[model samples]
Target: ALALYVNHRVRVPGTADIVYWLADEWDGKGIFLQDADALVYPYENLKKVCEHINEKLPFVERIAVYATAADVLRRTPEELAELKRLKLGIIYMGLESGDNEVLKRVRKGITAEEMIRAGKMMKNAGIRSSVMVILGLGGSELSERHARETIRVLNEMDPDYVGALTLLFTEGTPIADDYKNGRFHPISEFESLKELLSMVEGSDFTDCFFSSMHASNYLPLRGRLPAEKERMIRQLKTVIEKADQTLLRPESYRRL
Candidate 1:
């Protein structure tokens, strides 16, 4: 049986790492003011904070932080290598969408090329990269393009983990406002499944744990890519063929 560790003191090694609260938001556009709410501590201050944590918690096996693709790409190879040496094994990033047009629509600033570049750098530095892509991000009109481009990008990056989340707008967000003004068209559940299916079919990964199991997704699927790709696709196809709501997560169960 597999050994389980819970509620125990760190007698041996532990996986929990201190997530240093560096910044509230990433300046993907490179236009935020110094006093803006987007960034929390400046880079120098963040480094000092990380150093302090490392000094205090020398036994921790990993340290992680969330960053935008632009922010991550801004890190030089030396910085990534240094971070790896510091036991910072992972950097979580939001790719959102790989289609440049969709990225522009969302004001995400960084292009798909930038994300790929950053992923390669992180991989080379021995950092486990966890990245997310938003489904239905391009609305109904560009759904296919979004899926195709996202699959292409993921295949290129081949990050350690891939998270797929369906798009949902919070109140007052630009996308929500666009929906109110009839400028955006949300994809139906069935249509979203088609997009997901297309993405899974098109993807070609060496080894990555891919999942659309986020709460926002209409259906949950998780498996290793290429190895379990066919099984995942078959699961989705079963639901599509049945056209059964009972087989799918209900709308009331969906959450952001």
Candidate 2:
């Protein structure tokens, strides 16, 4: 993929690093920003970098900046005003499983209260945000909280987009280690689908774009919420109930 993606005709230096790209500074030394989420960058700094780049050759047809796990650590709600000051239009976040216990077990480094504050901060900043969740992070140990608390978080922030990614244990991470050592156990494929469906079963955010279509998920699904969510949930459930272990998402999908 790397060889194929490198275009000789293209002179762009940086492949894809939001921090560098924001500054019109793209170096090839791209480190996959993976520390739960990218919510840590200060909005003021982000906005300054973004505004500077757009001044010359605008790289955006439509402006959309994501701050995944905004509710986790990257930044706090108080810093959202900086985004508007810089004229940013979009913010994306991953509330990746609302269960507090699950978050603790995974060592995500943040709490439910902080997550709520972070989301509200994004909304107040006038930067539209997308909130995501992991369907199977809790597994059997936290099944009840997994479904209940997720809804609780969603109810609070009610982001512009609510997405879901079924948990996929990547290589050598703490979560993966837990899985190997029996310290952590995620839901079975079928149960995961159930958790996903149940978490958003009666969600009030009708306008949020819901996507479970990423490569990491068992079911690649997408739709608007409140209305189609039920049908979408049921459809996913059907697949999980029917398919065997072979139906699981390919482990290779997780690289980081």
Candidate 3:
């Protein structure tokens, strides 16, 4: 069962209350919720909760939900349709990297193939996917491979929205330990920009919005893919040519 908590906040004229909840169990993808169980609410129970919400607060415009690609893949077309019917706009997917080697090293527990299938499933069911990829996830060793592979995956998935965030390490995580032991080498600012440039330049999307405006990113960029591809690449190229540290976000200011 999912627990709901109501926060009285106004974003519109009427009461713009936001209902928040944690899933009874969630599919583990990475360090975040790594051990979470893959449990889903019963349809009847889910519907009843929505009915209760509708009765109590009728002004809510969106209900946000987080799920892994595997979770989305597990959903039947009917279930996905029902979720759309319930007004769930976009499902947040943290696709850390599209490189299979990086994925295995990180223990993501799902494959690029699964992500592609899941993304298509959402589109077929009239649901939108907002997928995110980590910029330095493949580290220095596989930076180029990461970017190219990510482009490959995104081209196939063709997500409605794509987010690019640079990797941020916490002290105790496995990846952090790897870094400490010299097993993993973090990419430099220029290298990260190179990867980002390659990703945007290589990707071929059918009308999708791409952004690297996350705080962790050294350079922030947002534009429509393919259409604004040249513009974005030019901007990256300018910064790359300048090689100005002032043009990039400082390491001290970067965060998760």
Q: Backbone clash tally for model 3?
A: 0
Indicate whether candidate 2 or candidate 3 has the larger lDDT.
3
Per model, how many backbone clashes are there? 0, 3, 0
lDDT of 2 at 18: 50
Predicted candidate 1 versus true structure: per-residue lDDT over 1-33, tens digit per residue: 001221123323443333111112322111112
- Please give the RMSD of candidate 3 to the true structure: 7.3
Quote the positional error of residue 130 for candidate 3 in Å.
0.6
For model 1, the run of ten residues with the poorest summed lDDT: 1-10
TM-score for candidate 3, residues paired by index: 0.82
Q: Write the per-residue lDDT of candidate 2 for residues 1-256, one digit (tens) a residue.
A: 2222232223345656453334445333222233443345555655566566455325332345545453334554455565455455666666777777888887776777778877777777777777778887887788777878987888787777777877776799988998899987777767777777776575777377778777767667788886687778778777866777666666666332
TM-score of 2: 0.72
Each candidate's lDDT (Cα)?
0.78, 0.66, 0.79
Candidate 3: residue pairs that collide: none
> Which regions of candidate 1 fall more than 4 Å away from where they truly are?
1-44
TM-score of each: 0.82, 0.72, 0.82
